[model samples]
Target: MSAQQRRGEPPPLPEPLSPLIDAHTHLDACGARDADDVRVLLDRAGAAGVQAVVTIADDLDAARWAADAATWDPRVYAAVALHPTRADALTDDARAELERLAAGPRVVAVGETGMDLYWPGRLDGCAEPSAQRESFAWHIDLAKRTGKPLMIHNRDADAEVLDVLRAEGAPETVIFHCFSSGPEMARTCVDAGWVLSLSGTVSFKNARDLREAATLIPPGQLLVETDAPFLTPHPYRGAPNEPYCLPYTVRALADVVDRPAELLAEQSSDTARRVYGL
Candidate 1:
């Protein structure tokens, strides 16, 4: 879907099931600019059975925003880090600030960090592989020190990401956010005891491998997210996404894993809570 199409009207909320948590989202990107906006957005989500959301940071400014956003509501939590694409901006001062934010009580993970090889030469200002690797290692260390989960963002660099995690010594809890790899990678992550957080991508018609991978995840290691304002579930593929749209993805995932939607919803929320320490 085109960017314009994806930014169009928000999809209608799906039927409410057991309460679920949007393990990852971007409230700032979803037009939540203040405490009131945050409450409104989350209220809509609550109506659709989404009980909580973890807003993730992709840059220094966003990390600051996410940390404070968490204080705006009880249901909101935060994950702070520089995205791999923006690893070039992780200067000393930025790193110091991120260290502070990552230790915040409301900040639950050090994340949205890893390798994004898909954007290097193709996207302007994308970080080089070396810089991305260095930043990812730093974030992993922060997660370890803070006793929080490491939330990873891997795109077309699964092998490299896995290698870096192994070399650097991964945190006790590691989550592969928006996991899009095939079953082989999925199995690797599962075997390594890493959590795989699926997004609306799993609901796409062409995501056969992702659907198959979903079936491999044990309930304890599985989580769900909207990755909101992007990757809206199918039938609303090109529409604007928000936490309220999460049930659509959950129902879709249920079909993929051959589990009842309510059971999957509870399991995903429980796994999210345990991994994030919510």
Candidate 2:
């Protein structure tokens, strides 16, 4: 059995100290495959004090599903993009369809897109880094054209990703989703007026760099996410993650920044709304 199964179902966290938003997640990946699945998951989140969540899609089929999923539930919004590793899928035909889905109602951001060097030599059959870089630039342009926030997914390619953003001149709103860099990177992003969206990984006991980065972002530039079905927070590190698991990360971030949990939630939610225009 998986660790999560051996441990049994994950339990609910205490109700959030204030309203919060999950800046990124993938409802489809979380086993919320349809409206009913989405509702069941979202209801759990609502009861836990999460007011909204953005379901991000990393491929064309999932992008279509994500755009539709956003409309299926009132509290769920969407962000559509080709994940960097899947950059090879961004053919002319895919690009056309992505543009259409990006403009779909309730699609709030353009991302989970950026360079990810974690899988060199086609790990998991990923496209090469050159292809990933090409795709990242195209997505950046789409964000500008769509007038949506650009949500980036940087993995072991911080310098390269940031360089592309600088070279291409970023869209008006840029956010580094699931930020995994250090305090220096955090300061650099904030200096560039980009938002840093923290994920459950921040709660890991060994995440000292992440903790220090948390201290660098101003409240206005800070946001949080679950990156569900992955990066499940500590104390439940191996548990199945869903939107309801967000409070753990929020509480963790609140502690690291030495801010009141409620105030942090309030501000982070506000930042999410402004960044995504939700």
Candidate 3:
């Protein structure tokens, strides 16, 4: 059994009121290693109305896995990047390999890469802001060169993330993956035509600001992601997250915007397809 199952698996929520795409998740981290394993996971997600997904990478090996996983099922796609937290890992050899993978079939976005100040101060394997800035810039350039959407991972470094984006000239498609900021940041992003991809955090009682941000997002600018194997939605916050758990977050978001879950799902799924060209 996977660790998630061992940790007390919660059955996938009832089928979503409408079909939705899990814009970001990690099949490898969820212990899905082969085509058969991926099929089982996709089967569960399909049963819950998550008809498609974009599994994201945080490092070279993960990127390689993501590219291959995308081929395992037509329902699956991939995004490749060295995560902000692991920015320092983008070595010369790694970059070339990543470039090769980014251009590979079914690799849609060039991210989950941005800045994170939440890690310990520039030591003990934690990347310093300088290294992260350099890496973020590289990823930005790569996204532009590849003509792929840039999926950003901002954590406690919103200002810096914006600064680099502005300097680099935001990509035609920019995604604030797992948006954890407040109204001010939300407005800035929306005004710039950047997409806000909300995770399960919006369902947390303490995330009043994030919930409010959701309401302000325009229909086409909104997207949903599970960030699975982490950030599981409320009522099961600590349970190992997976694409199948996406319905819970969608329902919570619908409540936040006071719209039917099906409507929100359709809108977000449409935007997801446009952004990722699914």
Clashes of each: 0, 0, 0
Better of 1 and 3 by TM-score: 1
Can you tell me which runs of candidate 1 are displaced by over 4 Å? 1-7
Model 2 lDDT, residue 246, Cα: 90
Which regions of candidate 2 fall more than 4 Å away from where they truly are?
A: 1-5
Candidate 3 lDDT over residue span 145-256, tens digit each: 8999999999999899999988988889999999989999999999999999999999898999999888889988999999998998987877778899898999998889
Candidate 1 local distance difference test against the native = 0.94
lDDT of 3 at 266: 93
Weakest ten-residue segment in model 3 by summed lDDT:
9-18
* Candidate with best lDDT: 1
Compose the digit string of candidate 2's lDDT tens values, residues 1-278.
45665675774555655589999999999998789999999988988899899999999988999999999999999999999989999999999999999998699999879998988774877978899989999999999999999999999998999889888999999999999999989989999889999999989989999899999999999899999988888877777788888988888887888988888889999999888888
Q: Give lDDT for model 2.
A: 0.90
From the highest lDDT down, the ranking of the candidates is: 1, 3, 2
- lDDT of candidate 1 over 1-278, digit per residue (tens): 65556668778767887679999999999999999999999999999999999999999988999999999999999999999999999999998999999889999999899999999999999999999999999999999999999999999998999899999999999999999999999999999999999999999999999899999999999999999999999888888899999999999998998899999999999998888888
